[model samples]
Target chain A: MAETAVAVHAPGAGEIARKRPYIPVFVILAVVTGIELAITQPGLPEIEHSLRIIVLVILSTIKASLVIAYYMHLRYEPRWLALIPLAGLALVAVLVTALTATVAHP
Target chain B: MAHPDSVDEGGEEHHGSPWPVVIAVGMGIGYVGIVSASIPILVVGAAVFAAGAGGWVHVDMERPSRAFYGLAAAIESRFPRVSARKLALWLFLVTEIMFFSAIIGASWTLRLRTTTPGAAFQAPWARPGEILNVLLTGANTFILICSSVTMVEALAAIERGDQRKVRYFLLATLLLGITFLSIQAFEYQKLYFGDGLTFTQVPAHASEVNKLYGPTFYAQTGVHGSHVTAGVLALAYVTRKAFKGGFTKDNHEAVELVGLYWHFVDVVWIFLFTIVYLI
Candidate 1:
């Protein structure tokens, strides 16, 4: 059925119709999520709670990047477009850091 | 059919859809229903919303409408490089980031302050898998991750002008999204009624587990679940559009944008599952 749809709407001139090389990215995401889950187990009794929190945050950032770059098509878009979301992340960093510090001491 | 951008295409057929207006009205009604807190009104609003959404998809599936608005021209205009739609999406995402951060930050602050020993007033944070169903939600996390894969593939299929693959992948994503929501509903029932974790009320026989559990549980998962619901609705709309053949190789910005939002939602859930369930 999908083949029929593709056949019917043949690619227009100058339009890029290449297959996205995405399977490897999915594999990486799965591996990262698995690692994230494994690190949370109680078996790592020696690790401090704060370090665990840091690890989880870092893992989440990596996963978010994968989705933004590939699924969001940021890599295919113009380079300047990247700055828009980066601004959001910068704001988030300032907010989280400030809030975390204040809460920690207060 | 020749490209819509052809030089002599000024008189080409216009397939302008009316569903956008219908959607706006439905949303207006739904907001009114929410404010009124009337069950009947809410149901009516939801019906209107669903019908508008269904009609929109129905129109989208028919054919790809051509446009002379070249990407270069789009970028060169007032806002230029990024289209208005793309800009709006970015702004919306920024707000979403803040929204999730607020929830995650509040939960973290609560956990940190509560777990402090002999602090003025402190309640111990629940350890991993203590008062919640962590493994079940973990599995749900994986389910969401799989949906993201299908979603990305659907976008790819559209890009390749492979409508058949697009439809199949979209249908798969929709099914996965529905399954995720169903599991969430089941989880909510078990937690709220069976295990005594209500939004405001805790069970009478509750321990310290019942004290602060309500806030954190709802804050973390509630926000995430709402996002999942939104994604599910979007998935349904896009799937219906796919069935009607709404997208083509070069004119499917809507599908791509929706896919971006869905993937972002999946990423948010991944982190939520880690913080709320695993940690």
Candidate 2:
């Protein structure tokens, strides 16, 4: 089906078609979600307390980067374009730092 | 179909459209109404907003959605270039990141401070799966993830100029989005009424939970849910456009932009599910 679509929708001269592994990515996401649920299940705490959080955060970040880079096509667009989101994240870093300080003092 | 930038005879730039300005005016009126606490003013603003939105949709449905090759598109006339509209959307998303950060960050800080020893918040925090329906929301998260997949596939289809696949994938994405919202509505109904987790009410059986829990939960998830609703509406619009032969290989920028927003919403949920539901 993908081959058919790509052939029929053939891009004009300079337009590059994205050939991402859409289904595989979906499978990976589903698997990761399953793992997250499994780790948190009432009886099964395979991961430790503090490390559990780091694991979940890492998994979630991986999923988000997959969506942003592949699905959002940021990887394919001009590199400078990524600076926009990075700038947002930079401010967010400040926000998190200040927020961390508040949490500490509170 | 040639590249959008290629030369063609008499390619006079599109003049302009009035719908955007009208919508802005409506939003301005709505803002004033909100500030003044006037129901009539709010209703009037909403009416104007609806009328403007309908007018715009009607106008757009009449023709294939095209790149606005007008004065505003000139912003892209530089080097290492990106389309002006795409750049604008990216910048818009940057603000959205901070917006969600503020919401989630405040909730996190509140949770931390309240949980600390001898603070104003007296009630113990709800256990991981005590009151909230984690399984249902996990399923909802999966639905959102699937919707993100279909959305990107729809863009891929259009990029290849496969109109049929484009239409079907779009319709699938639209339905998936609707399914996600429907599940969320169901979850909300169960929590608010059946489980007694209301704006101002909490169940007697779960009285140990902090009062702030209900409100902060609603505020954070509610905001993100509203975004999903908006994304669903956009999907519906794009699906209709796909069916009407409104996009082609040469001019499918709308699909990409809409997909960007949809994927961003999914990205937001990725963190939200971890923060709100898991941890």
Candidate 3:
């Protein structure tokens, strides 16, 4: 039940697990999310449609990169590891573009 | 003892949790019930699912199962390539991206085509903050963001061998996940019962808007909610293992992977908020 404690200082592994300041990133996320909400109010439907889509997509990408880099330890792992998931993403992009095009026309 | 420091491919044993199977059975039955329109079967399925989930949690709380310590990790070096799991997850995410793109793209297409007057089945998109409780959902979004931070911090703590912080951050993340879901449940309750949104029907007063709103709302949010639920279950298992002294600075891959999943879920929500509520 206390695997976290074990992982923390397990005899000789503490060198890897250390603390860092994450508050700033959290703050950025909060501010961006707030902006997303603010710009999406009713009176600005015309403005909300395109602008909201762009900002939200950007914000989510940023958030995903942070998690992948820090939490998933992709930064520390062999660089080759990154390519594995990237390949998957590339395929997904193709699928999406194809499907979206079909939906739009059909 | 096997050289404790020497990393083996399969360093630990994974006694897979039975709860997942139980939950699956419950869902299967519930699905059948829905199709059959059998109230008792549905209720029974739900009860079994709940019981299985409760038992699984109880088991996890008891202790982390022994690690499988599969030799796959050692064998991974033979390929001298990208770690298999990381590659697999990325591939999975890519598919997920497409899945979401389809949903969002379809919605956008509807918004554009229908907004034109006299178009077949013409109706306007819901204005921002018109149908949704924007402020409340925004707050929930904020909560999800915080959980993402906590999840990353937990991984960082594991990296530094700070067991206490790892536990603290993971626990914090678990709570934040619950809070976000609670807010969503509240939102759904208000929308379905209070605001008259249902799967196949819209409120009497909402005719000016496209009828697609109900299905879209449920599709996007329902999928996200299921992801949150999965994250919660993963956290619970990891937390139990943390309590059992399972992970070590060198062997905490489980925590990191789960954090990745949690973050991915958060990323999904960020887009979801934008598309469903904001746009």
What's the distance in Å from true for residue B188, model 1? 1.6
In model 3, the runs with Cα more than 4 Å from the true position are A1-21, A42-52, B1-95, B109-113, B116-118, B201-206
lDDT of 3 by residue, A51-98 (tens): 657876786677667656765567766676677667766765776687
Q: In DockQ, how does model 2 score against the reference complex?
A: 0.42
Q: Write the per-residue lDDT of candidate 1 for residues B149-222, one digit (tens) a residue.
A: 89988877887778899999999999999999899999988878887777665555455543566778788888
Q: What DockQ number belongs to candidate 3?
A: 0.36
TM-score of predicted structure 2: 0.90
In terms of DockQ, which candidate is stronger, 1 or 2?
2
Q: What does the lDDT read for residue B214 in candidate 3? A: 82
B1-279 per-residue lDDT for model 3 (tens digits):
223333335454344667889999999999999999999999999998999988876664544332222333455555433334545666677677667767766666666666666677777777767777889988898888888888888777776667898898889999999998898999899889998888766776675778878888888888889989999989988876776666655567678668878888887787788778876
**Which residues of candidate 1, in runs, are more than 4 Å off?**
A1-19, A43-46, A101-106, B1-83, B118-120, B200-206
Q: Scoring each candidate complex against the real one, what DockQ results? A: 0.29, 0.42, 0.36
Name the lDDT of candidate 1: 0.74
Query: B105 in model 1: Cα distance from truth in Å?
Result: 2.5
TM-score, every prediction: 0.80, 0.90, 0.75
Ranking by lDDT: 2, 1, 3
RMSD of 1: 5.4
Model 1 error, position B172 (Å): 1.0
Q: Write the per-residue lDDT of candidate 2 for residues B1-279, one digit (tens) a residue.
A: 222332234443243557878888888899899999988988888888888888887776655544442333344446344555677899999999999999999988888788778877556667667778888889989999988888888888887778999999989888988998898889889888898998766767788787778888898999999999999888888899899888887667788889999999999999999988888
Supply the DockQ value of model 1.
0.29
